[model samples]
Target: MKNIVILISGGGSNMAAIARAAQKEAWQEKRGLRIAAVISNQADAPGLALAKNLGLSTDVLSHKSFDSREAFDAALMACIDQHAPALVVLAGFMRILTPGFVQHYAGRLINIHPSLLPAFTGLNTHQRAIDAGCRVAGATVHQVTAELDHGAILAQAAVPVLPGDTAQTLAARVLTQEHLIFPQAVRSFF
Candidate 1:
């Protein structure tokens, strides 16, 4: 089976979705793939508890404990490599990885972003999209690159921004889309 390791910094809805999808017979029997671990940067992240409840191995390597981003990433990579993951999924892993870290998992790493990408590449995407009067907003599943969200797009799901939509409303809509597409993209990789 192809083992996957998911990195998260918050509630891992996307990670859970992908795990559930992989559990299906179509994926487990037809394609040999599995979620091996869920690692978080924050020890108290609620997702760690969820992952434990689902019987998945979990780890928390606090960024504060490391001397540098490089040190933290090195430790993170070591923790992930212990499982020998065939792929690493970033499901809200908020930290910016160093170039060397990104290179180590090149082509085998993927991430889900709240914006359609190449439009709003960084934080505050929902507010920015609404402020810019974008009629349509969406989520993107892409390969993680050294250039942040500037990666090869694998998939996207567009959601309409209503005239009265607030950032919270927009975010909620986009999150639903994210949960759907992220799992599909992971399945495609398998």
Candidate 2:
């Protein structure tokens, strides 16, 4: 069976969506896709508990414990390797991985960025979009690359930035689209 490992840092709504989709679609029996593990950099990450409830293995490798980004990434790589993941999915994983770590996973690594991408590459994307007076806001699932948020997009879902929308309201709508497209993008890996 092929293993898919998810890395998350927060509530992991995206990770939960993927797990739910895997179960609903019978990915294990149909595509030989199993969620081998869910790893978090923070021990208290809510997603870890969700993964546990779903019966998926979970681990935490706090970046704060490591002396440097490279050191932390090395340890993270080791943990991920233990699962022998065929694919590494980043669902709100906050760390900026080292170049070596990104290259290690390369084509097999993917991420779900909260903006249409190429537009808002880093944090505070929703607020930036709303400030810029954009008409559309959305999400993108793309192959992970050395450049932040600059990868070959595999899938995207666009939601209109409604009139008089605050950053919070816009983000909420985009998040809904994210839950829909991210799982589909993961399934496409098969």
Candidate 3:
């Protein structure tokens, strides 16, 4: 079976959702896909436990231990290469990867961003969208490129910015769409 490795830095709700979808969709039997591992740069990341509970191998290569961004990327690349991942999913992974590392993974790397992308590329997307008076806020699944959050979008799901919506509320709604679309986008890769 082809292997998929996921990277995360926090609670990994999207990772959990993808794991559930893989099982429910029988991706292993049907599409020859398996979640080979879940990795994090933070040792204290709660997603490690979630991945473990899902019976996936887990690894933590703390960025603090590395001398530089390149060093961390090299170690991370090594860890990921060991699995020979057919695809690498960034599920809330919070690091700005080196360009070399991004090139190494190239077309096989993908990420889910909180905004429609090309709009709010970096952080604080929800609040930025709210402040900009956007009527719709959404998520984008895109091929990972050296440029931050700028890549060929594979899929997107839009949610209306309801009246009186706070950033937290907007984030919550957008996250729901993220859960749905991420798994679908991953499946489409095969």
How would you encode candidate 2's per-residue C-alpha lDDT over 57-81 as one tens digit per residue? 9999999998899999999999999
Error of 2 at 85 (Å): 1.0
Q: Pick the candidate with the highest lDDT.
A: 3
Clashing pairs in 3: none
Candidate 3 residue spans exceeding 4 A from truth? none
> Against the true structure, what is each candidate's TM-score?
0.97, 0.99, 0.99
Q: Write down the RMSD of all candidates, one decimal each.
A: 1.0, 0.6, 0.6
Candidate 1 has what TM-score? 0.97
Q: State the C-alpha lDDT per candidate.
A: 0.91, 0.94, 0.95
| Candidate 2: residue pairs that collide | none
Q: Judged by TM-score relative to the true structure, which candidate is superior, 1 or 3? A: 3
Model 1 CA lDDT for position 178: 96
State the lDDT of candidate 3 residue by residue for 53-108, as single tens digits.
98989999999998899999999999999999999999999999899999999989
